[model samples]
Structure formats: C-alpha cells, structure tokens
Target: MHNATVIALRTVATILILATFVPLLPFEAWYIRIFDFPRSQIFVLAAFTLLIFLVLRWWRYGIDKILIPGLVASLVFEAVNIYPYTFLSPVQVQQAPADAPADGQLSILVSNVYQHNVEHQLLIDLIQEHSPDILLTLETDSIWQKGLRPATDSFPERVAIPLSNTYGMHLYSKLPLRQTRTRYLLEEEVPSIKTYVQLRNGVWVELHAVHPKPPVPTEDDDSKTRDAEIVLVGKEVKGSDYPVIVAGDFNDVAWSHTTTLFQKVSGLLDPRIGRGFYNTFNAKYKLLRWPLDHVFHSDHFKLVKMERLPHINSDHFPILAILSFAPENKYEQEEPQPDEDTAEEAAETIEEGKEEAQEEDD
Candidate 1:
C-alpha cells in the first residue's frame, strides 16, 4: 500500500511537470495555448509534489532519484519564469521623481468590462473615484455604452465603437485628442483605437488601445490572428519618435512569447516587470488568475503610480497607471530590442496576417 501510494503521487507529479511544456509548443491549439496562463499554479503544484516525494524518501536510490531531480527542475523552471514579475527582480520602468512636475503627468485607467455584466454603477463609481486622465473600456456593447454615457459626458474626447460580438471598445479622455483613428486591424470584428493626446504640458503622446481575441475553442481556434494583430502594431510603432502608451486586455499572459516579442519589436516597456504580475482576470477564482490586462509604455516616461482597482462585477479588475513624461530619463530605463531572429519572426507574423487578409478578399 505504501509503495502504491508513492507510485500514484509520482505519476501525478510527472503529469504536473510535463503540463508546463504544453505552452512551449509552436502549435496554437486552445489546450496548448491555455497552459501559458498558470505558471504560478504549476509552480505551487510542483513544489507540493516535490515535498511529498521528499517526505516519502522517494529519493532513496532507484528511479526515485531521477524522478525527484526532475521534480526539482520543474519547480525551478516555473520559479524562474515568475521571478521577473516579483519585487525581487530589478525594476524595468523607473519610478518618477517625487517632485516631477504635474504638467508632465498622465493617468490612465483600463478596464475589460465583461459585456454581459450589468454592474455599470460600480464601474462608474470606480472611475469617478480615480478620475484618470484617460479611460479605455473593452467588451462594451451598445448597452454598456448607454449605461456609461452619463459618466463619460465629462470626458471631452471620446471614441466609442459599440458592437454586440464582445469585441466592442470605448476610449474616453479629458485631454484633447488629435489625429485619432479607429481601425479594424485584421479581423473586421476586432477594433483598435489610435490617437495622439495633447498632455497638460502641451506635449502630444501617442496611445493605442487594443483588445485582441483570445485563443479559445469558441473565440479563435488559434492565436494566429491575435499574434498577428499585435505584431502589426509593434511594426507600426517600431521607429516612431513619439512617446507611446499601449493599453488593453491583451488576453495573453505577461510571460508569453508573443507578448515578449511585441515588447521587443515595439521597443515598449512593461511596468509590471519586477512589479508583480498584478493578475487582473478570473476575479472570482484566485488560482486561475493571471495578468491579462496591461499597460506598456515607451522608455521616455517614468512610472507615477499603478494599481489593480477593486472588482466591479467583471471578470477582470480594472488597472490604472500614472506615467510622467520625462524625455530626459528615456535612456535611464532599458527598452526591449528585438534581435535579428526575433525581428524576422515578427515580420513573418505580420506577413501571415496580410496573407490572411488577402485570402479573405479573394
């Protein structure tokens, strides 16, 4: 009975360890893609398994020795992936000086208001309390737009694309908007908003709001479309001289390969790096939570404040960030740069998207 128990535990441990590799596969099947969302859970499971095996003296010679080490390795691997997002890691985006002029500051609030959710007042209250300079909401249909209308009246510049398919987006800003464009990037259903906002200091900062479809059995069979959309945006911002801020519910994890590539190609910096995952999704399930909503900015700005706001009856908790434009400190933070191989991969992703578009046209 004792040996049998050990064998069962060992088997379960092996499965947990191997599950981590599913996300590493180049394929984009929903099952494979989902494995990328639970690195923290995997780490916990691996650690528990390792502890149990150690207590059972499973490392006392035989194949148990090999299995024990394997478990250790698996635990270590997950830890490494999550370490960068923790406070222990070096800060990726430097904090703004306490005395930084208010004229150079900008606060943004991003929320993925689940379309079916009807708690509009909660969201409205949250927004009123924070009163960010810019607000972007995702999954907003006509109902959400109507519900939010009263609160948004205060925002002088607004971009509302109301849709029923859960891909709806809205941008409300108090700052003056110049040269704003609403685009249906790859999929006609998935829309993105790009605009230049004149900051308080009279400096214009480029902002892009996107909410890509997730790799799921129902929404999208693979991540191709989502990856392509992000890559194309990265390509657009690659050589731009303007200070940029990209915000949205990316539906992708912070540690995923595609997000890393996007950051590198676009030269944007994720403030979450070394600042904790700030997991925003699966608000009801603690174990299933991961950072899906993000705010990536150019190195020309420094972090003023970042917080995961209280849940407003949505699956995602809104994220708010305040950034101070400091061109002089641009070089203080290291920007992500794509290597030759990564650049080629980004190009290929963009090309694949164009080809998909051509096929649709044909």
Candidate 2:
C-alpha cells in the first residue's frame, strides 16, 4: 500500500511536468496548442502537488528530490506567463480620469452567442441594460439574426452576416460606421468585419471584429489558420494611421504565445493586463474557463470600465468595456513592438497559413 501511494504521486508529477513543457514547442498542431489554454489551472495543480510533497516529507526520498525541483520549475514558468494579467504588474492600458469627456468615449459589448441557444430575450435585455455604443455578436445564424433584430434596430449603422456554419458575425453600432467591409482574412467560410467607426466626437476609430476558426479535431485540426489570421491582422493594424480597436471571440487565451505575439506585432494595449483574467469562455463551468473573448486597442484609448457580464445561456459570457479616447496621453503608456525575430516569425506563420489554406482548396 505504501509503495502504491508513492508510485501514484510519482506518475502524476511526471504528467504535470511534461504538460508544462509541451506548449513551449513551436508546433501548430491542435494537440500541442491546446496546452496553451490552461496555464492557470496547471499552476494551481503544480502548487497543490508541491504542497502534498512538503506535507508528506517526500523530499527525504531520492526520487522526490528530482520531482520536487521539476514541479517548482513548472510553477515558475506558469507564473511568468500569467503574471502580467495580475494586479501585481503595471497596467498596459491606463485608466481614464473621472472627468473624461463623454463624446470621446466608446463603450463596446462583445458576445459569442452559441448558435443553437435560443435565449434571445436574455441577450436582448442585457444589451438594453448596458447600452454600449457598439455591440458585436458571434455565432449568429439566421435564427439569431432575426432574434436579435429587436435589440439591433436601435443601432442605425450595422453589418449582418448570418450563416449556419457557426462563424456568422453581426456588428451593430449606434455611432456611424464608415468603410464597413466584411473580409475573409484566412478561411473563406470564416468572416471578419472591418470598419471605421466615427465616434460622437467625430474621431474615426478603426474596428476589426474577428471570429477565427479554432484548432479542434472538428475544425481545422491545427492552429495555423487561426494564428495566421491573427498575425495578418496584427500586421495590418500595426501601420494604421487612426486609433485601432480589435475585439471578438479569438478562441485563444489572453496569455498564450500567439496573443502575446499579436500584441507585440500590432503595438496594441490589452486592458486586462494588471487588472484580472476576466475569463469569458466556458460560462457554464466555473472550474474550466479562460479569457477567450478579448478587446485589444491602441494606446490612444484608456480604460474606463471593463467587466464580464451575466451569461445569456451561451458557452461564453459577454464582455463589456468602455474606453476613453485620449491620444494626447498615449505617450504615457508603452506600446509593445515586435523585434526583428518576432517580425520574421509572424511573416513565416502567415505564409504557412496561406499555403495550408491553398492545399485545402485543391
């Protein structure tokens, strides 16, 4: 019985250590990339395992001496990945002053309404209560389109692309939207909305609403398309003359390598940094959740308020953020820039994604 208990702990420790290093590999395979989503969970588990070792005085054994060090190293690695999202780190996006001008403010609400869920009224009520200047909904099919019409009718300017493929997207804006274009960045069936939104102050802010195909067995089988799409958009937004805001269900966690690269390549600020994780996905399960839905913006804006809203019977809870446009204060915040190596890596990822996409077509 004593040997069996020792063996069980050893086996669990080995699995945790391997899981920690697998995501560090430069592979785009779904199995490998999926490991990037649960750093927080891994950190908790590693800490718990370490506690067990300490309580049992396992370090007295030779085998445990090796396992304990590996567990400690894993904790350090996971902490580095998730540290920026905690309040202990400085905020990437500064907060707006209490006297921030109303006209210069833009409040956006983003929701990934699971296509099959028909609790349309609950979503509508939430939208009405929040009254964001912009509302972006993902997984909107024909049924969702019609169902959301009552709430959307108030927004004079809109873009609706309803499809049954679960990649459908809709953008409703109370403010005027100019140069609105529905683009297929990487995958033909997947659509992303791009437009210039004229704020009440007459400032035109470029907005990109994207819902990239995730890397799952039922989906593309890898994250190449998703990573490529993200990198391509990051590069595009990098040189924009106007302030930029990119929001949607990225299907990627905030702390993942690809998301960090996206921020560096685009020079955008993540408001969640130094605030909290603000996990938005897996709304039904508290134990398994990550910040899959995100809103990234240029340093021209400062966060006023950001929160995860109540669930609307969907797999993802809606996220609402109000940002004050204060470009003059942009110098106060530091924007992340891609170095030579990061630039080269992003370019290669984009090319690989295009090649893989072509092969699929053929």
Candidate 3:
C-alpha cells in the first residue's frame, strides 16, 4: 500500500510537470488556458514545482518510484523558463550613454490593454510619462483604438488590426515604419507585426511583435497552433543577419519550453538572467502571477534597464524595456537544440494542424 501511494504521488507530480507545457499549447481543443482552465497558470506551475520537492524526499528513503521521471521533467521545464523567480524588482534606466547619438537609443513598450478596460485617460498618462519609441497594444478593439487615437497622433506611423473580439492588436511607432507586414501568426486576424525601426544610427533591425492566444477551455486555447506559429516566426529569423526583437503578451511564462524554444530558435537574448523576473499578468490576484508579457532581443544590444509600469485598468501591467545600441559579437553563440527527435514531433504536430485546417476549409 505504501509503495502504491508513492507511485500515485509520482504520477501526480508528472501531471503537474505536464502543466508546464500547457502554455505552449493552443486553446482550441484543450481547456488549459487561464480563461478555460480550472485554475491560473501560476497555481498549476507552483504546484508542479512543489511536487519536485515532495518526490525528491524519496532520496532519503532510497525509494524511487517516480523520482527519476519527475526530476528529469522538472529540470527540462525550468531550463526553458525565461525567468521563474519574482525577486526581480525594477531597475532604473541608465542616465546617459557614452557617445550617445543625437537620436538616442530606441525604446519599446508592450501592453496587453484589456478590451473592457475604460481607463483610457489613465493609459494616456502612463504613455506620456514613459514615451516609448514603439508601442504594441493587445486586446484593443475599435473602441479602444478610438480612445487611443489621441495618443496615436504623437506617433504618426502605425499598424492597426482592431477586432470587437478580445484578440485585436495594434502597433504605433515614433520611428520610421519601415517594411511593416502583418501576418496571422497563429490564427486569422490575430495579427503579428513584422517591421523595421530605423535607428538614429541609420541602422535598422527587424522586429516581430506577437500576442499568442492563451491556452484556455472556452477560447481557441489549443496552444499547438499558437506554439507552431510563433516557432515558425523564430525559424524565419534563424538565419537573418539583422538584429531581432520579439516581444509582447506571449501568454506563456518566461520559464516555459515554448518561450525558450522561441528564444533559442530566434537567436534572441533574454536579459532577465542575472536580472529579474517581471510578472505582468493577473493584476487582480497577487499570489497567482507570472511573467506573461516579455521583450527578447538579439545580443547586438546591451541591457540598459527594464521597468513595470502602473496599472491602467487592464488585466495586464505595462512592461517597458529601455535598451541601447551597442556593437555586440554575433559570434557569441548559443548552440541550437532543435533536437532531431523534437523537430520530428513538432513536424508531425504541424502536419496534423494542416490536416485539421484543410478539413475545416472543406
């Protein structure tokens, strides 16, 4: 009976580990996304991480029913998190840059402004204070766009993809809106903007702004489609010589395999390491929180500072990153681990999606 109990506990641990991958999946088939799931990602993730502690106790007794599997699962899971710890408080932006160009370093702001949120003035106040060079807003319907029109005048260049549904997205830029193209990364009309921001230095780097649908029960939450779409974007950037910046409401935490794969596949650098984890979602609940929004870049830039802005009547808090243009060694490489086996699995999944999409078309 005792041995059975141990095995049962290990199985539970395994299920929790499975939750780590939930954010990577889509919302259509599975009911795992926050909107449809039984609980928040924070709760499931914490429980799974705790399970590691519980199963680790077997080492003391020399009993190992599910210990090995649980440990392996947890290790792989944590290895992929962008940053799981919340100890990261805000850091002040650098006062000045040596030989700073006249145009100054470019700054990007990402916010998942809830559709129902009415605090348009509050958001305006925050925007005026931060003044990002480029801004990406999610869940912005036509109403929200109208409310934001006043602010849009300040940044003449813009890309607007508004929807009455909660998935609408938009981008406004103070920099030259060079070569902007909107792609339906995961789903139709759920747009992701790929553009170039002409820097003050006369140099330009590619930018990919994405707001993948969270895996949920009622919504399109099967993250398989979402994950593949985002991964394909990373694949698009795999061989590009242009520095890349991919940011926005990923719905996945910093510590998930999907996000890590996005980072690895895109050759992007995460500054959170030796830094901090800035949890941006679930402003309603303190205990249940993780970094759902993110900003990742290529190593060509130096980390100047990153900050979390005040709540502006949205479910998500605004995350702003102030980065500088510094020449970096492109050769400082991270070995790609798109393991052959994993690629084959992902390929199979993609083929399945194509089949499903075709059937739906039929």
Candidate 4:
C-alpha cells in the first residue's frame, strides 16, 4: 500500500510538470497550443500537489527531492505568465480622469453569441439596457441577424456578415462608421471587419472586429492560421495614422505568447493588464474559463470602465469597455514596441499562414 501511494504521487507530479512545459515547444499543433488555455488550472494543481508532498513528508523518500524542484519551477512559470493580469502588476493602459470629457468617450460591447443558442431576446434586452456606442457580435447566422434586428435598429451604421459557418460577424455602431470593409484575411470563410469610427468628439478611430478560428480538432489542425491572422492585423494597426481599437472573441487567451506578440507588434495596450482576467469564455463552466474575448487599443485611449457583462444564454459572456480618447495623454502610457527579432518572427508567421492558407485552397 505504501509503495502504490508513492508511485501514484510521483506519476501525478510528473504529468503536472510536463504539462507546464509542453506549451513552450515551438509548435502550432492543436494538442500543444491547447495547453496554453489552462495555466491557472495547472498552477492550482501544482500547488495542491506540492502541499500533498509536504503533508506526506515525502522528502524522506529521496525521489521527491527531484520532483519537488520540478513542481516549484512549474509554479513559477505559470505565475510569471499570470502575474501581469493581476492587480499587483502595473496597468499597461492608464485610466481616464474623473473629469474626462464625455464627448471623447466611447463605449463598446463585444459578445460571441453561440450560434445555436436561439435566446436572442436575452441578448437584445442586454443590448437595450447597456446601449454601447459600438456592438460587435460573433457566430451570427441569418437567423441571428434577423433576431437581433430590434436591438441593431438603434445603431444607424453597421457591417453585417451572416453565415452558417459560425465565423459570421456583425458590427453595429451608434457612431458613424466610415470606409467599412469586410475582409477575409486568411481563410475565405472567416471574415473580419475593418473601419474607422467617428467618435462623438469627431475624432476618427480605427476599429478591427475579429473572431479568429480556434485551435481545436473540430476547427483547425493547428493555430498557424489564427496566429497569422492576428499578426497580420497587428502589423496593419502598427502603421495606422489614427488611434486603433481591436476587439472580439480572440479565441486565444489574454496571456498567451501570441497575444503578447500581437501587443508588441501592434503597439496596443490591454486594459486588463494590472486589472483582472475578466474571463469571458466557458461561461457555462466556472472552473474552466479564461479571457478569450479581448479588447485591445492604442495608448491614445484611457480606460474609463471595463466589465464582464451577464451571460446571455451563450457559452461566452459579453464584455463592455468604456474608453476616453485622450491622445494628448498618450505619451503617459508606455506602448509595446516590437524589436527586430519580434518583427522578423511576426513576418515569418504571417508568411507561413498565408502559405498554409494558399495550399489549403489549392
């Protein structure tokens, strides 16, 4: 009985340690990249294992000395990735002052209404209640488009792409949207919206609404296409003359390597930094959730208010962000800039995505 217990503890410790380092591999395979989602869960399990080890006084077993170090290292790695999202870290995007001008403010709501969940009235009611200046919805089909008409009617300007493929997106804005274009950046079926939104203050801000494909067995074999699309958008936003805001269900975690790289490449700031995770996905499963939906903006904007909204009969919850466009104070917030190596890596990833996409099409 004693021998069996020791072996069980050793096996569990080994699995946890390996899981922590699996994502470090330079691979895009779904099996490996999927490990990127549950860093917090892994941390908890590692901590629990370490406690059990100490409680059992397993150090007397000698082998535990080796396993203990591995567990500690895993905990440290996960902590480093999760720390920036906690309040203990410095905020990457500054908050707007209490006296921030109302005219310079813009509120956005982003939701991925699971396509088959037809409780449209719940979302409609939520929309009517919040009344954001801009609304972006993913997984909208023809039925969803019609179902959301009551709420969307209030938004005078819009871009609607209704498809059954679950990648359909719709962007409705109370503020005027100019030069709106629906782009199939990498995959033909997947669409992204790019446009300039004229804020109430008459300042033009570039907005990109995207719902990139996820790395899952049912979706794609790997994350190359998704990473490429994000990087492509990042590269484009890097040179934008106007202040930029990119928001949607990223299908990637806020703390993942791809997201970090995107920030560096685009010079965008995430308001969640030093705030909270604001986990939006897996609304159905509290224990298994992460911040897959994101809203990233240029330093020109300061966060006024950001919150995760109530679930509206979907697998994912909505996120609302009220930001004040304060370009004058942009210099106060440090922007993430990509070094030469990062730029080269981003370029290579984009090229690879394009090649893979072309090959798939062929």
The residue-by-residue lDDT of candidate 4 on 1-362, one tens digit each, is: 39898799899999999999999999999999999999898999999999999888876777788899999999999999999989999999998999999999999999999999999999999899999999999999999999999999999998999999999899999999889999999999999999999988899999999998999999989999999999999999999999999999889999898999999999999999999999998999999999999999999999999999998989999999999999888999999877779988999989988988898899
Cα RMSDs of all predictions? Answer: 1.7, 1.0, 5.6, 1.1
TM-score of each: 0.96, 0.98, 0.76, 0.98
TM-score ranking, high to low: 2, 4, 1, 3
Q: Which regions in candidate 2 have their CA more than 4 angstroms from the true location?
A: none
lDDT of 3 at 235: 75
Cα lDDT tens digits for candidate 2, 1-362: 39998898889888888889998898999999998998898899999999999999888888899999999999999999999989999999999999999999999999999999999999999999999999999999989989998899999998999989999999999999889999998778999999999988999999999999998999988999999999899999999999999999999999988998999999999999999999998999988899999999999999999999998999999999999999899999999877879989999989999988888888
TM-score of 4: 0.98
Q: Using lDDT, rank the candidates from best to worst.
A: 4, 2, 1, 3
Q: Candidate 1: where is the Cα deviation over 4 Å?
A: 1-4, 61-63, 354-362
* Model 1 Cα shift for residue 141 (angstroms): 0.7
What lDDT score belongs to each candidate, Candidate 1 first? Answer: 0.89, 0.94, 0.69, 0.94
- Where model 3 places Cα greater than 4 Å from the true spot, the runs are 1-104, 328-346, 359-362
Tens-digit per-residue lDDT, 88-205, candidate 1: 9998999899999999999999999999999999999988999999999999999999998778989999999999999999999999999999999988878999999989999999
Q: List, residue by residue over 205-264, the lDDT tens digit for candidate 3.
A: 888888866666555536666666667777787777777788888877665556666766
Task: Report the Cα lDDT for residue 84, model 3.
Answer: 31
* Candidate 2 accuracy as lDDT: 0.94
Say which prediction, candidate 1 or candidate 3, comes out ahead on TM-score. Answer: 1
